[model samples]
Target: MQRVRVSSQQAAVHKLGDSQMTLSPKFRLPAARSTITDHALDFDNSLTGEPLIPGFPDDVALQCLLRVPVDQHTSCKSVCKRWYSLFGSKERFFTLRKVLGFHDPWLFVFAYHKCTGKIEWKVLDLTHLSWHTIPAMPCKDKVCPQGFRCVSIPHEGALFVCGGVVSDVDCPLNLVLKYEARKNRWTVMKKMVTARSFFASGVINGMIYVAGGNSTDLYELDSCEMMDPKNGSWSPVSNMRTHMASYDSAVLDGKFLVTEGWFWPFYVVPRGQIYDPMTDNWENMPAGLREGWTGSSVVIHGNLFVVTEHERTKLKVYDSGNDCWEVVEGPPLPENICKPFRVNCWESRVYVVGRNLHVAVGYVVENYEIATGGNGKKGGRFCVRWETVDAPGSLFDLTPSSAQVLFA
Candidate 1:
């Protein structure tokens, strides 16, 4: 990749492979043949049209504009329609913006688009209350099965989205999709251990573990498997006893915690159970969640936060060490989130995104606080404010309940 900087004008041209990209006042982008012509457009509408907002070097101004959040950049577009026009066309600004990384304190969300009936993906920057669309992967194989929910696993510098579909009645897709930010592309990875949807998956160390989801026949998986990205193969890890069909799992205290979600009983048996990978055994955590709490659940600060349509004014928090359920104070969701759905936790926050009648809604993303009030004693209160963001594309079952990545 050869990069050339032309000093004749305000902006510099980046030469990569055979493509030449122009920057500054007016961007004279290279043609399809990777050829650059003298013809160019000026940002300033002057006689000669030197440049708009001069004095600052073109390179510096480009960098600053790129620094602004992409979601907020939409507002910048309204400031000057010309500036908005530069977004999709200019190559320099796009290249620089992608590299900056959306490492803001936020939760990325993906919902099943009822209008198109395809999955709609987005990321929410909790701090800024912004939304950006993430492009979906090109499912060339058409083998990518759909599960009920989507999960995102951040690997290397790319986020891997996999699993889930409303109707996996036929050939379910167990394959995973990896999205690269720099390239702005999605590539299909290896398949998961089993063909099931509505299950939970978490990432620990260098492996991805998915547990307990119904198959095409609506048969729930009893065992969990681990995937080594290096080998692109699945290996046996442990089996969960409860056979929870729609439960959530997270890595807590260096071990995985699977909670909430539910199972259909044959003889009226309790459907929920919690499992610890270290011990390879499922233990009944707290008694309150026995009825099967749905929605989304997350494990933060050694406590479990479960939200559902069943309960809105309060959030259920379970103490891992003591194995006790504590009611925490929190605001009710936007009313749409109380229905059955999947929840994801990232950076001490919980996000719930689900669908009803194929229409997606809920707390696209929000921060969570843990109030310590259990056993007639005031424990402690911890809160984290979060803003929503749109991941680049529609993702399925990226990361299970408790498994999440925090950029601090």
Candidate 2:
């Protein structure tokens, strides 16, 4: 039997015994679709009379577009003027995604090339387990990794890369760059009032705060400031009791905690501070809390957890009532996930990015209890389930400096 080739237009034609009918042109597939470049040329056209998707209601079309993978958002925005307007505005697009339950959690890794010391960002789509690169940051000067502080307003789909040092000149920079996930674009925001490096920064009540970092002369800075993301304006905040650069930091219970981690040689105890937004003041961290904060930290469900930086890399949760750290009931950190890692969490899951971009995810359960004996003796325990994912070979040369989770 011979097969007949039907043109797209003819494919829409139907026969009904004695009668023949053709579907509406809107229902027919075009033989050749317009290229993105062609659509881009009409970007300036007004969307006042244009439908988001042809032959469909704007609301239905919006729902369809909301389901599109975030990686393809740029291409979708280039499809038409109305789409560009929707995808380019964070308030409209991200707000809709949040309201409609279409946003997804993504892991953003700030990594640097070990050989060249060049810094870049990579994003992991948690839902699909895929990786993609974001646009290059606006910094023109050479900079070092781990010298800047990154913070985000996850629900707003925004990430901010704050102050850092210029590697070539050994100068601190106040440059602030904002990445809008919805549009997949970067905007250079207002610079911080103080140039700093290796600072402690966190978001509280939609405001970004930075404190206790190195200044231009490599002197530890005790000065602090807060930025209202809405206006991109910075204002002075109360200074820390002492000048200390952050070795690890977290925002828990609506406050920012910064610790100058323990140093080798066992000389002196490290210092830590907690900043309360409501009071706009800083308080000394509890002795037990700071003394045992031995590694990077991430807050989950209002509880503070840490992955130890020492050998074996144990997981621990802070017992605030006792002001001490308790071991989490879970397997040790994956052998493949080595030291020099970065940690971040969302909801009950913890993400640790180790050398070579290897990731280990820990699902945590708090306040669990285990029965010890027939006498009914029970011990309170925190449990974690571990899972690991390997990095692509292309990312093997990159080492993570920071990791953040954003919803988009």
TM-scores of all models?
0.63, 0.78
Any runs in candidate 1 off by more than 4 Å, and if so which?
1-53, 58-60, 71-102, 140-149, 154-157, 165-170, 242-244, 260-269, 272-295, 334-342, 352-408
Worst 10 residues of 2 by lDDT: 14-23
List lDDT for all candidates, in order: 0.50, 0.81
Q: Write the per-residue lDDT of candidate 1 for residues 1-408, one digit (tens) a residue.
A: 122444577765643221233233444433433222121222222222223236754444554565566566656766554456545432434444443443534344444443444554555545554556557765532222345334444434446665655342344557677655445567777887677766766667666777787776666777787777676687777678666665555565656656544444324544565666567666664555554344456665555576644555245665545555554443555443324444665545566554331112222122232232233543334333223233333333232221223231
After superposing candidate 2, which stretches have Cα over 4 Å from the reference?
1-101, 369-379
Q: Encode model 2's per-residue lDDT on 137-210: one tens digit a residue.
A: 98954898889999999888899999988899878899999998876789999999999999899988899999
Maximum-TM-score candidate = 2
